[model samples]
Target: MKKNGNREEFNREKLLKGIVRSAEKRPVSMDAITNLVDRVENKLRSLGENEVSSQQIGEYVMEDLVNLDEIAYIRFASVYRQFKDMSVFYKELKEIMEKDKKKNQDQDHSGDK
Candidate 1:
């Protein structure tokens, strides 16, 4: 269901198109975007629920996008999350950066051994 409480069928093509729009002009490839869509669809199906909310789908998208492409993630986030102000948007960016920094640090240490 949407935030407006309207129920609709989940469209894989629609999801793919939105990701494409967000990832446009970026280094992200169609293969990566398609895999993200496939993963999200698989996750939703695994839920075994009759219906899922748009918010849930958005979260799923963000989860994968964050790892796929930061710019596209931010773009998708600004729309999916509807940031009310710059502060909120900045906060989100900071969080993503922090996560990325930690990920890099972990990889660095793993290679040190």
Candidate 2:
């Protein structure tokens, strides 16, 4: 079992629940979610620590979801980051857009003959 900063036993079920909720109405499959959970568990083991922060776990989830589904990634991020207001939400969305834009630009430049 993992422990959070608060020194409480981390609930793995809660992690799965959050992923499930984020994937709701999205194209993410149950198999993918299961695989993600396994990956996160492996990550925790790889850390070889007695306790791990919720923030760290959330980061791993966000990284996995970002590649699995953008919508699900945003959904999980909004909740995990606990956005205080629309401004925060907007900022996150803008950052994601900018990252995608830059990635596309780099790809386009690389493809140029």
Candidate 3:
């Protein structure tokens, strides 16, 4: 359900449109986006719930986008999250940077083995 408590059927195209908008001019391919959407849709179906909040859906997309493309992730997040100001954007970018740093460190450590 949406924030307004109204219920509607899920539209795959609608979801695709949102993701496509974020992926514009990015390296992410249509196949990847379609697969991501498939995964999200499959996940929601697996929930076995009659209804799920729109917020939850958005969160799921954000999770997937972050792994797909950073630029696309930020683009989608700015809209899905409705970023208020530069501070919010800064915080999110910082988190991504921190995680990336940690990931690189882990890879470096693993290579030492």
**Cα RMSD to native, each candidate?**
1.0, 2.5, 0.9
What TM-score number comes out for model 2?
A: 0.84
Query: For each predicted model, how many residue pairs clash, with residues at least 3 apart or on different chains?
Result: 0, 0, 0
The TM-score measured for candidate 3 stands at: 0.95
RMSD of 3: 0.9
Candidate 2 deviant stretches above 4 angstroms? 1-5
Best by lDDT: 1
- State how far residue 54 of model 2 sits from its true place (Å): 1.0
Candidate 3 lDDT tens digits, 61-108: 889989999999999999988889999999999999999999999998
Query: What is the total number of backbone clashes in candidate 2?
Result: 0
- For model 2, give the RMSD to the true fold: 2.5
User: Which runs in model 1 stand beyond 4 Å of their true positions?
Assistant: none
lDDT of 2 at 72: 93
Task: Give the candidates in order of TM-score, highest first.
Answer: 3, 1, 2
- Residue 18 C-alpha lDDT in model 1: 88
What TM-score number comes out for model 1?
A: 0.94
Error of 2 at 24 (Å): 0.4
lDDT of 2 by residue, 4-113 (tens): 33666767788899999999999888999999999999999999998888888999999888878889999999988989999999998898889889989999999786
Ranking by lDDT: 1, 3, 2
